[model samples]
Target: MTVFLIRRLMQAVVVLFVMSLIVFIGVYAIGNPIDILISPEADQIERERAIEALGLHLPMWEQYLVFLQRAVTGDLGRSFAFSTPALELIVERMPATLELAIAAMGISILVGIPLGMWAGFRPESLAGRAIMAGSILGFSLPTFWVGLMLIMVFAVHLGWLPSTGRGETVEFLGLQVSIFTLDGWSHLLLPAFNLALFKMALVIRLTRAGMRENLLMDYVKFARAKGLSTGRVIFVHVMKNIMIPVVTILGLELGSVIAFAVVTETIFAWPGMGKLIIDSINQLDRPVIVAYLLITVSMFIIINLVVDILYSVLDPRVRLKEMKS
Candidate 1:
């Protein structure tokens, strides 16, 4: 297991290096650095001075090496547009994004799993049919459209939740709750649910399909013949086997949820990495862009590594094969 983990970690490092290089090259190819440095009416000497100041005369490889070295040392440079250290900016904004992602994933797993289990067990029942229909609709709709509709219905029409912003000035349990603080959890519900709707449907469908397949396996029949309780045979015996695929999908989807939240964050005015990325792009803030991309890639690599480790623990067959090899 240690050997496997080391191998994966080395692979992740190589992949990240390549990602940084690609992003740097792609951005550089579009324009010269001097263009950003010089004003429209700048004289020739001024242009030369600006060029010298920013090291535009240096080779691209040298610049890339410098960038890579700084990145490895956790010294992502200041944003070109915002004039703020990229790493520090990201650190400041990360909590809001992390909180939103956690809320969304929690809702997806909680609602999707039960709905899927029920649908799989009673395929022809009205509840099952409704779940299938809703899942399809949820899966098919565009995320932005769904977010807007939710904002319209829940915020505008019903007025049950705030339209945007973290929360209002209020007291909870005799404690003053600030919108920018932990008390903001109340304002997070709509955005979290909106972001999770598609993921929930996908998980439900995957779980239902896996459960149905497990239910038809010969071992399930044997369990029934041996007089195992229906719930035990289904939930205990079948569910474990069915979870292999579900677990894999869930891990992959976890990263995707973060990516998709970019749009949802913009729509709902939720402060997150997604919104940060968008703002950075609009301002041509290279450092922040690179930092955000690196963070995103690292997230996927970390999640996938965890998934691989969990697979070995969940299934002895995988562990045995790895050991033998």
Candidate 2:
């Protein structure tokens, strides 16, 4: 186990290095921030000073080296647009994005699994057909449009929920979270569901397919013949087997949920990192953009690593295979 962990960590380091290089180069290619930072009428001398100050004076490789040096000490550089540390800006908004992503995943897991299981159990039933039909809609509709429709119905017409903002929040475990307050939840529900809709449909489909396949397995029949209760056969025998794939998809999707929440965040005016990154991009804030991308890459790598570890736990054969390899 220790050797496995060490090997994974080494791979993560290499991947991080490659990703950081890509992020830095990609952000640099976006355009000269000096164009936006300095007035068009600014003279050559003024432009030179601005460029040097922002380190555009250096070659691309040189600049990346400097970036790596600073990054080694936990400095992601100062945002040219905000006059603040890029990481600090992201960290401030991280909690909101996290909460939204988690809420969405929770909704997907809690609602999709049972509905999927039921649909699989009785695929021809009216309720099962309805569930499947809903899953199709969830997959087909665009997230931004769904968010807008939600705002229009709930906020514009019914006036039951606020259309934008994080609403009220209370600090818990050093993080500002809205889930603790009723006002916060009222603000949270629409966007969470909006973000969750697609993932829920995916979960429903995957779970249903897994359940259907498992129902016909010899083990299921054996369990039934051994006088196991239907609930036990379903939950303990069937659901347990299906969870490997479910967990794997969910683990990887968690990172994507955070990264791609940009659309939903923009539509709902969500004050999360998604909005922050968008603003940074428009301003051509290189430092903030680099920081955001690197952080996102790190998040994906970490989540994937965790998922690999989880695989061994879910199926001991996975660890045995690794050992044999």
Candidate with the greatest TM-score versus the true structure: 2
Deviating ranges (above 4 Å) for candidate 1: 30-57, 168-183, 320-325
Model 2 lDDT at residue 270: 84
lDDT at residue 323 of model 2 (Cα atoms)? 53
Candidate 2 lDDT, tens digit per residue, 50-159? Answer: 99898899999999999999998999999998889999999999999999999999999999999999999899999999999999999999998999999999999999
Which regions in candidate 2 have their CA more than 4 angstroms from the true location? 320-325
- Quote the positional error of residue 270 for candidate 2 in Å: 1.0
TM match of model 2 to true structure: 0.97
- What lDDT does the true structure give each of the candidates? 0.80, 0.93
**Most accurate candidate by lDDT:** 2
Q: Which residue pairs of candidate 2 clash?
A: none
lDDT of 1 by residue, 1-325 (tens): 6787777878899999899999888767756645654578999898888666555667889988888888888887777666688987876666667667778888988999899989999999999999999999989998889988988998899987776766643554443333344437658888888888988998899989988888899999999999999999988998888778888888888888886589888998877778988887765667788888888889999998778778777776787237432
